[model samples]
Target: MGSSSLRVYGGVAGNDRKAERRAQLIEAGLELLGTGDGEQGVTVRGVCKRSGLTARYFYESFADRDELAVAVFDHVVSGIATATLEAVDSAPAGTRAKVRAGLATIVRTVAEDPRRGRLLFSPALSSTVLAHRRVESTRMFARLLGGQVREHYGIGGSTALDLMTEFLVGGLAQALTSWLNGVLDLSEEGLVEHCLEMFLAVQGGRLEPGDGAAGLQAGTG
Candidate 1:
């Protein structure tokens, strides 16, 4: 290779290293947030200490705590979104499989790491980060609905899509938050079944007797 090619390759490698370090810092911050009482949350100093990087490095990657919060929130949510999309994309060509695949990702991702799920679904961050957190999730649900609605339901419209997408995002958020708060008793499998049953009900479809219940598991002291 020419000297110019070598220089370009070297620069690319350095950039990747920098990006990896930045991601590490962000992940460290997220980890700290998951620890402790969660009242203080994760501060810039705390993150720098946890990351073993200087405050200067944290600034080099993020402007402030809120900015870092956004980055951490994005990092976590995007991982879940990617997994959900892949599950939905590869599901068998049927409404049942597709819906199960999408909702299953939600429940599994939350249950996979209860701490991370709490952080992601908690009101522990700024309002801005909280608001933007579900944008990707909502978009994923919309895409998931786009294919299934047309194929199995034989229904298609911007309005219907918007409603179903809202239902999925809002419902999942509420379900996870409730479970985190001890209001809902939902196992990984149970949550997936309940969510799909609720979706069908909201879409004006009836639940079969053996499928699942739209009601919450009762009694919490």
Candidate 2:
């Protein structure tokens, strides 16, 4: 069928229908994978059952259970990362402002949808495909952070910046995991504030190519 004729079903296009089904499967995967049940929760049959779709529809979106799980993880991570970037872009200038803006967006995004939090850090992720994806995500965040830090510092290439970014990314991930697990003993606001401080503190350090953010302070973002 041509593209225009694909919209015959209640005015919804075939591609749109497929996208909806794909989203449904991903959301179902999120529910299963983010639960305390972990990796085992993301079977194809389980996803089909959870999404209230047939096996045929499930295969239409994902090649396998692992693919769906990976898609769910990527979706959540992409959501938070994209929101954080937008928040930072709209925020007022200054090191603290940018940091606070980004941090607050991340915390709020996951808080608004707790599933994203659990999906990213649930204990159920032990020694699974999700674990590997988590590591890869950390690297992506590190690159983003490192680039932003260098831009703020007006600095050039330096391995120390890379190291610092990795530390921040890994530390933040662990800290967020603790927070989500109820071991951090802090409210979402408190978590964001604390993390903002830490990020600014690190940004304040003197790297090889540029000076520290010596005069930055906590304020409106």
Candidate 3:
């Protein structure tokens, strides 16, 4: 079947069905990414097979594997971002508490499926793929952290916020990589607790022993 017969999601007549199918394909791609090694996670063929949809459907919504990968990346990032925001935004009572909540949400979500976590942060993906994703992911991180910092601590307007956001994202990315590789032996709760500790220390809310986040604020600010 051609792209015409394959249907475009959310575009026009018969679009709802196509949109639903597209959502399923993206979901299937994420699941495949979960089960496979981080290295082989979610190829186009794998997504088609897992989604039980025709390859034509894939091309109908995506120009190529890299395009499909970008779609999947966006979908997954949106989910994680939503959950993380919710976790952080709910009445945390203080800046430190909210920051801890935010860190907890991030580490727990990534720890749940490390392969997808790795894929989200992989810099080696195609430039076209990486460009679209970097913008989306960076914006998501920036929006959440910027809002939280301003609301909880009176920080404003993309100065320290940018540095802090980069620190949080880069730190979490490295932590996820280490955990997935078995170098970091931390349970979800332990991950959340330890990560929050370092995050707070680095955020300048505390100065304690073993806080790898020391000097992070000065460097970023």
Candidate 4:
């Protein structure tokens, strides 16, 4: 019985060490991929060096650099989603307030960690794996936004709502990307205000048909 207990303890210790190494690798990937140098600096050797782990440990955790990049992207997006949801949930009862809270959380998060912003929004980091994960994350956020629309405006799930949510999600993405890349020239508060106004317009049905194109233009400008 003592031998069996020792074996189980040894197994747990090994698993914990492996988990720690995996986390280190993920952090290294985030540092390399999320920085200004972008994906070019995310080689396995670079990550291993940054992580202070050997290549063998990297291979144990990820199949390749693309996988690591995707993991880092997912991690960043997950944190953003969590913070937004928490802010929205904790806001006082009002659709506008909740929306502002959520949007503010997102803007503040990116502003706090510009590296995460670049990892998430930079066109330069759009490798196939990262791009695919981006689309997935966008769809998830759109669904959350759709829920908010339904709760706030009594909109049912229909083709039109689906299309509207997609447009809103895409517009938000472009707006954030431009803001992060310095094209928008907006302060953090200004960025949140712009996004909040657009969301409010959508809720009020105030946006004209051509407004979507105009919004994209403004965001890029």
Which prediction has the highest TM-score against the true structure?
2
lDDT of 3 by residue, 1-221 (tens): 64457555456646667787799887786676555554246577888898999888887787876666677788778888888889877845766677677777777777677656756755444356556776668777876776666555543454555777778766876787677667888887887788877777656654233333333344544
Alpha carbon deviation, residue 178, candidate 1 (Å): 1.0
- What would the TM-scores of all predictions be? 0.75, 0.87, 0.74, 0.83
Residues forming the 10-long window of minimal summed lDDT in candidate 4: 212-221
**Residue 116 CA error for candidate 1 (Å)?**
2.8
Stretches of candidate 4 above 4 Å error? 1-12, 152-155, 205-221
| Selected candidate, larger lDDT, 1 vs 2 | 2
Which parts of model 3 have CA positions greater than 4 angstroms off?
1-13, 37-44, 122-128, 131-136, 206-221
Poorest 10 consecutive residues by lDDT, candidate 3: 207-216
What digit string (tens of lDDT, one per residue) describes model 4 on residues 36-144? 4778778999999999999999998899998888888888888999899889989997767888999999889988988888888888888788888889999999998
> Please, what are the lDDT tens digits per residue for candidate 1 over residues 102-170?
889877887777766766666664365656755665676577665556545444445545665677677
The residue pairs in collision within model 2 are none
Position 151, candidate 3: lDDT: 57
Candidate 2 on 54-122: residue-level lDDT in tens? 999998888988888789999999988888888888999877788899999888888788788888877
In model 1, the Cα lDDT at residue 99 comes to 77
Give Cα distance to truth, residue 155, candidate 2, Å: 2.6
lDDT of 3 at 167: 81
lDDT accuracy of residue 27 in candidate 2: 87
What is the C-alpha local distance difference test score of each model? 0.69, 0.81, 0.68, 0.81
